[model samples]
Target chain A: MPLFSLKKNNVHQTGSGITPIVFSHGFGCDQNMWRFVAPAFEKDFKTVLFDHVGAGGSDLSAYDSVKYGSLDGYADDVVEMGRELDWREVIFVGHSVSAMIGVLASQRAPGMFSKLVLVGPSPRYIDDEGYFGGFTAQQIEELLEGLADNHMGWSAAMAPAIMGNPDRPELAAELTNSFCRTDPAIARAFARTTFMSDNRADLPNVVADTLILQCADDIIASERVGEYVREHIPGSRIVYLKASGHCPNLSAPDEVVRAIRSFV
Target chain B: MKSSGPSVPLSDGGEPNAPAEDLEDLYENAPCGYFSLSSEGLIVKVNQTFCRWTGFSKDELVGRRLRDLLNVGGRIFYETHFAPLLRMQGFFNEVALDVMTAAGEKLPVLANASERRAQNGDVLFTRVTIFPAAERRRYERELADARAAADARNRDLTERWVAEREQGELREQFIAVLGHDLRNPLAAIDAGVRLVLREQPGERIATVARLIQGSTLRMSGLINNLLDFARGRLGGGMAVQLDVSKPLKPTLQQAIDEIRAVVPERVLQMHLEVDVPVAVDHARIAQLFSNLLGNAITHGDPLEPVNVDVATRAGQLTISVANSGPPISPAAMETLFQPFYRGEGKASQQGLGLGLYIASEIAKAHGGRIDVVSHANETCFTFVMPIV
Candidate 1:
């Protein structure tokens, strides 16, 4: 494959520092999700940002249904990307489901990532026996149906124009105005995978020094879920933020930057 | 600024003097639900309309987070997509959500939210409006289903088209190989027949050998036509090698002579007026002429003389063959050059119906075309090409 074709992941890197800080975005959005926080560390670290295969300016054709059928496939990409960039002692910061993806990647390649910061992380979304994951099975199904309903409007209005200019920077900039615009089919699949995955069994195996940023009023991953993650992972610490939504990165970027700075 | 109409009474704050009770009434029972939430999403203020729609009193709704009234899925969407967008973009419009009413039923609504920021860039509160969308949601669901069905159908058609194209290419390749393989045996049989004829075998044996030779010649013509048809269908078209040094008169005469030997009783009148060193593919031209002559001999009235006109003038070459017979029907004329198209009521045993198609293809390869004219007395086929 050509070098540009690997831009299917749209990996972006900056800074002159030796320690690489790779930022992975959540389920519903792309790497632009980190715009408010990642730049804060650029002067002190080699800040890296990337979109997952099906999001943002990433090449949509690289999306394979079978490969992305589970979250493990996504973790494989992170590990592969680390190997490709030849980074050592990496600091991986992931938001939402990507937090769990970072955990999986660190476990897959034990010493590659040295530190992890999970913001509003949830090991599971659907509540299981003796555990409240913040949702029921039927409610997740309803969310999938709601996604289908909105996709009808979204694809009809935006897909053709966005698909026509995949490589245009102006188009990419325009897309950031909407922020969380994702291909509806890929969004639906990611939703099912993120909400349905059970990563509770994998948390205890994490060897990296981990920090969980728990935001108040985060309905997607509540404070209790964040605490649950901290309790399961050895040597992991949890900090409760005054910010109110799941995305403190956008709502309280200064607070998020402070939390990551103190930990790193 | 001056008021054009009667001056309205001003309040102490310089606002329009409307009835305070009416203003309160409008706020209490507006058509759509309206409310405001603190930056933390706790319901800071509420209208009676929103309270009534959710089956909750103002006292019950106030101070509760707006997400508490939503179902689990709606709550997740609010946190993940809606809240973040509202914070980053300052507004979100026409987002579909289901509010869990006090009666434990889902109320589908289209919600719009905008954030109010203070001068210091601190978010003071978020105002929201909600419209009942049960009917519209149902219609949207139907449209979504239809779009999904259309996408599936399009994918299926593309897959089938690719498979069909592959199968067609394989079939053409098979035909070309079959045509090539059959030639070696055919040449051997022709040579054997010629040796037998030269030895002057006994009369009955000689006659049988002559019949075999004729059959082999016809078979070879059929194979050549099959190969050309396959090549044309496979997108190579016809390949012609132009030889300017070779005289064209002998090639034209040879095609006529071959046709005459096949049908000795049919009368043919030839006219050739080419003397220039014409740049042309001699064998391909002869093949085209032979096909036209064979068609005329098979269809024309045997007693009538078939006219052959070959001439080069004005930097153009024109070869026309005219035969006297019954006029061709207009229906047959439309499909005359199409492959496997034989005339109506014609016996299938005469040929494979590819001769005219191959002849026309050869004409096209030479950057030329064949034209036809049929009248009450005669049907004519003409080949026209540039003499470059």
Candidate 2:
């Protein structure tokens, strides 16, 4: 199938700008994660929302392990989506792991994207010597083991912490629902790909104007990780949000919108 | 209070007007845990029953979210599924979760929540009821283990069955090799008999040589049938090497003459007319013709002539064997060409019952077909091959 149909790409044109802002979700969820944030840019930009292969309403048969083993595969999908849709001046908005995917895509097709907005971006999730990427290899292994044994249990336990709204249980509930709806095998494969990936070297190759939105108390992607991303990418700016979780798009959509609006 | 089985009576002496303080006591001491959360999921109010169930004080539980009382997994479930469902559908029911106490002990529970809406249609708060469900969760774990055990057993049984079938196939192929090896010894024995008969022994000794020769021929036929059956079953059907350069009529006639030598008492008739060279496997055709002729002689009436017909027309070669006999029953005809199928007949009149099956398989290997027609007056088996 064509990339547009295979990816379940949905286009909503409401703005006058020649550039289209495309929203790509991270590993654990789908395009629905951008429900609150994508609409904020509809009036000023041509907004695009799509599920990656094997997530949401995408063609699950299109997901081949070899094709999606690395961040490069997802980057290729973004570039192919542009070519299939005949789209230009693309403004890519990527969340979590998708931020590095966008960077890789922009490097491959530099003239395709005009700007990039990265939300809770993490180039390397595993911590190494002299660098703190928030998680240790052992911790991620435990997380993966928990997922393998009882995915529902893992989702229930981690969604609230990830959402950072223990006072408002609805936010945590939304995250868990998203996690449960995904295919378990695909979710496991994507989790390994997202957490194990190290895209630090590819960050300097990005030519697009990039905005990194970092949350205040994101345990998944720490403040140090955000700073690492900003330092590596040339001519990029970082805006810190008061929202105290990983998914500011769901927890605090207003702050995420404000950050993107000021940069664009 | 006098008649109510040692229970205390109402303070107002059966009056409908109970004090608000008394009603508050009933609400706090309810049998199950009861709590309410604001639309934002903050714990607006919780009864004493709920506080005691979770082993937390009122001060610690009141302002916190209901999800905060549960364990990590329960908190995730509350936030992801429970909260979203309450907001969207206005109610959620009987969701299983584990509540963690102050000392980190788990209490399994099933919770039901309903949204409280104001007149303006906005959600004011959510009321949740919790019930213990330890026994049900334990039962579910047992059921899961049982299913896993059954699946493992099924896999083991399937592997054993496959291994047994492979061993059986190896045994059958071994028998086929054994039958093939016996052929050389039998041929040697037949040659020795012929040489001794050439010496012109006395009449009494000559009779023994003739009987030995007859037994050897019969044994050889049985071995050939066994070998063919085994080859067909083990080596993916009978292997036929086609030699298009060979003439079909002469090859078939030669096979007919050999069958005539075997059954000299049966009157044989042949009508061979072939104007063109037909492409075929000559040795396999000879085997097929020999099997068909042998079948007709064994089953046909000795008083009637067994007919052999071969003709080539319109790029097709048709060979048929017809003999007079009782019409084959529908029951017998269905399995007539199947291997090891012996219909009701005299035991003395039986061969291996593999002759027709081998003939059919050989025909198929040459991309040809065999058809049989049985009637009161005649039974005919016809082989049709395209002259490619």
Candidate 3:
């Protein structure tokens, strides 16, 4: 297996009686983001964590622009991670933008994951003429400008705006710090790819039991996207967390854990 | 969703002279189907689109009214609502309507309609445009079905909860009375043993023996009452109707004699105020009298007088049993006649709650209802029934 040393993305094996749970991190962050949730699962579950190519400790040489640009490529990595570890019917929990990609991944490889726990994911960006996406064209252009101007400063300023609220002001800095830690070029490329994509049609064929736990106060991925996700996924359930940050697992991990535990 | 309607021809049953440019447009697409109707309600004119909708030709329907083309049920619905709305609204727009084609399949539509007004502002013709509503109609059906199912489930849950609450109350009351009912006979048995051991004098001996017999009878009667109550629950007496020609006095006498024997020393008296006879179930009448006597004995204060009266009028007989006792509180009176409903705060009383309940059920089965009125020193329970 070419000694698949993915930096801190090392694939360790521990098979307990409890069904395995896998975690996928969103753009601008790595599997370390799920550090709080991973340990809670360590005792009971065979927990697997991996990095998307070009992000986290993933090899910069292994980055392929054409394949990495599509969500299906990361989904492949998730399934391959499960196959390599030899876990069956595992619970795949994904955070932030990687949430919806988890659903698409499950649809691509049938029966690879038992159920999907999507924390925050938007199916489509650049809302159509009739639809209202919280952001205007000017705002998205400003975000791109913020990225181009002082990439680090943009991460600092935009993080609080997208990830946290005044009530949970600490989350703004924490998520921004998480974003600033990422490679700037890789983060910018992932942002462009996610914002430009549309997956409205693909949601219907999603047959996995879906739990969409939307943060009540995420500005970037607002509550309406949560509603759209629920409406598109047939027989899917959705609950709004009272927490006020984009990364709720970090801000209120107990509440997030309670929701996942209650549903499962 | 598009409806195939009739075609248009000129009056006197001839096709109109085609204007070359209008003819060209007609062959391609005109939103409304052209149809002419005779004064007698026959369709005279139709266009290609109307022909496609109704699956009929201009030649076939040159003399049929718009009503004749509609399905039987659709015709009634159109005349009742659609026609009036169209006339009053003056070209109704987006009217939700359903129509049947020649294939007898339903098509949902949003119809925008206008009448071809003449110079005098009277409608000589009508034009309608139908757009398909397949997706919207399907969604509406699903929404309605979900709401209806939820409502039905709620109603069922409410009924089940009420029944469960009633059952629980009945169980508590039944358990409380089970002790006293069984103890009465046991006490009588002890008294019989004491009398036999003591070898008392002649007068003492007879009284003690009568007490033992009366107490044992009350105990056995309680057991029998319990059995009848079980039968009544399964609608045991509904199949049996009262023999209207039967006499009522003997049955009342039998019940009074039995209760009188139970408490020989107590002054329980009967007063027949009316000599008229009644048409009723004799066995149930005996049961009613027996239950009334027991209720008076258990609920009335010690040494108070219990009085029974029977009266009759034109077609109904009214029987009243009054006892000088602790007045039944108003709250207790409300559910007094209910099964297992002893008076409020009277759960400790020494009577099976089933007595009054069984008596009332019997009354109802005999085509009557019974009620009670009470004051501090006087409580009267009355049973009224039609003679016929």
Candidate 4:
């Protein structure tokens, strides 16, 4: 379970009570990621914001290896936030790993949330039996071992690959500095949880109105994985933004927010 | 010596005190080291040749193990790599290892070791050879340096070849574009003449025929200018000269008038600034003037005037053609005098990109140089030739 709270006054509005929205941040990040989209929707909807365990402004004591072992733990946290807020009808928008957790949590609370918008979520990270995920076991092993070896270096290397895309080439430096400021311990733990976790089996159970905004890119998620997500989720829709890299929120923020706003 | 003799005796088998064969002839004088080690690796015997080879007295090394002579790193390598390879091969040949002598000096040497077994198949001793590698090391360094120098020279030659190839291709591309400058208008003339001959045959047609004749002649002159460029490059050191015995005034006037014919109705003002009759190639001088004149007309702003000037000083004939023009970039100025070089993509001027190229070539052929100084709104092209 994650330790976090949605500061009530911090939740401004841009939308009516049609469906109150919750912004769940991706791995290694906090609710501060919704700075751009939150204001755009704050006046109309009751927006709920929170941080995951082992992340920004969250309770460090609540973090446990067993509960947070699978992404299902994060799913429980998002669902609990909806219940606490009394949001009967909710649109849960997530970025990166939180996007997959959103799918799992929405699957759990089928009647609680009306829609799930997954931004840059990759399921089944490793290639199995007869598939290729670009990353070999050696690479995954190196990622885990290297992160443990030097968390700060790993984050520095990875942040640019995710953010410095051709479409939004400027985001890389911002993300590099932002991720560098993150505490190394929390980032390492989060890195282990993000890259090493496999979320393929959870996709089929997601019945919420799912909208996956996968940036047309090479680094973060490939078109194959995006298609895999769309294929697995029964009625999920995918929109491939003509952009590159993993974190299009910082790169293609307007395009991402627009897809969510219009999709609902 | 010891009292015991060989148990497997000679054919006579008698207890005869036959003089023992000289041990020197038997082993000490051999080129390689010969030694016998006990089963526990204690050296029982070694030859004088081995002692001399290792700079050790026989007494110092005869009872010592072979590993003592090897460097620590060499010992590790021998045990790990050499021993394993030797075990598989039975008789190791030329296994290279480093050795530290009694003086503690490192020597690179190749050794061949073999197990000397008895008839009963029990291990007896190992035989080895150590050859000095100083000469081989010297030879290797010499070879490497030579190879490196040769590789560098080859690389430089390859770069020069590529530059020349690209230059040739640039020339071809320029000529192909110049074919448009020399031929496009000529083709228009050809078509015009054919139409006049077939449809409009009369005195009016004669005027059209005259225009065609004029274009054909201009194209012929452009072709001659191109040929002069080829001559400059291909002729290397040898060149044809215009006899200085011919008067300079007449030659300058001929050049000015010829250029005037090309750019008709354009006001060309000239000054015969030379006091003494300067010696120069008449046609070649005119070729230079024509290039400068054409460049001024093409690149100079249409509203601005073209001025021609001539001056002589200290056995040098200086011809200056000044024009009003926009500033040429440093990059363009750097390459402006290069033969057949058009200034970037915008140099689609009427001349066969060879005008300036041939002009420079002509100046070089006559032991002279052409230089240009241009700034915003003004440009002056000067040709300096040594008085023949």
Judged by TM-score, which candidate is best? 1
- Candidate 3 C-alpha lDDT tens digits along A10-129: 454454647888777776556656655676667677777767777655676766677768777667666666556555667888886677678777877788777888887677656677
Candidate 4 achieves a global lDDT of 0.65
What does candidate 4's lDDT look like per residue over B1-388, in tens digits? 2212354322455446964344453466566667765544457777776677678887788667665676543442343234433322234555545566777776656566665666654456666666666566456447656866999999999999999988986775575456446666667776766677677668876765755655565566677676556544443432657675776777777766765655566677788777777667687777678778778877877677778888888888898888886877898888787665675435455455777777787788788988889898888889998886
Candidate 4 — which residues are off by over 4 angstroms?
Answer: A1-264, B1-214, B236-238, B344-350
| Tens digits of per-residue lDDT for model 2, B10-101 | 35455467543355566577888888877666787777888888788877887776766765434433443445345433565556677778
Candidate 3: what's its TM-score on chain B?
Answer: 0.50
Error of 4 at B12 (Å): 51
Candidate 2 Cα RMSD (Å): 10.6
lDDT per residue, candidate 2, A1-264, as tens digits?
454653443333455555688898876557767777888887777788877777766777778888788888888888888887666768899988889999999888868898999998998988898889877787677445434433333334333333432334444454445533556567768778888999989988888999999988666788999999999999999999987656777667888988998988
TM-score of chain A of each: 0.91, 0.86, 0.82, 0.80
Interface DockQ per candidate: 0.38, 0.05, 0.01, 0.01
Tens digits of per-residue lDDT, candidate 3, B235-351, equal 454334466566777788887877787676667778775556566777777877788887887777659778888878877888888888778887777777766565543665665
Each model's iRMS: 5.6, 8.1, 28.7, 25.0
Of the true interface contacts, the fraction found in model 2 is 0.00
- Candidate 4 chain B weakest ten by summed lDDT: B80-89
Clashes of 3: 23
Interface RMSD of 4: 25.0
**Whole-model Cα lDDT of every candidate shown, in order:** 0.84, 0.76, 0.64, 0.65
True-vs-predicted CA distance for residue B37, candidate 2, Å = 4.5
The TM-score obtained for chain B by all candidates, in the order given, is 0.88, 0.66, 0.50, 0.55
lDDT of 1 at A152: 42
Q: List the residue pairs that clash in candidate 2.
A: A156-B76, A172-B79, A172-B80, A173-B79, A173-B80
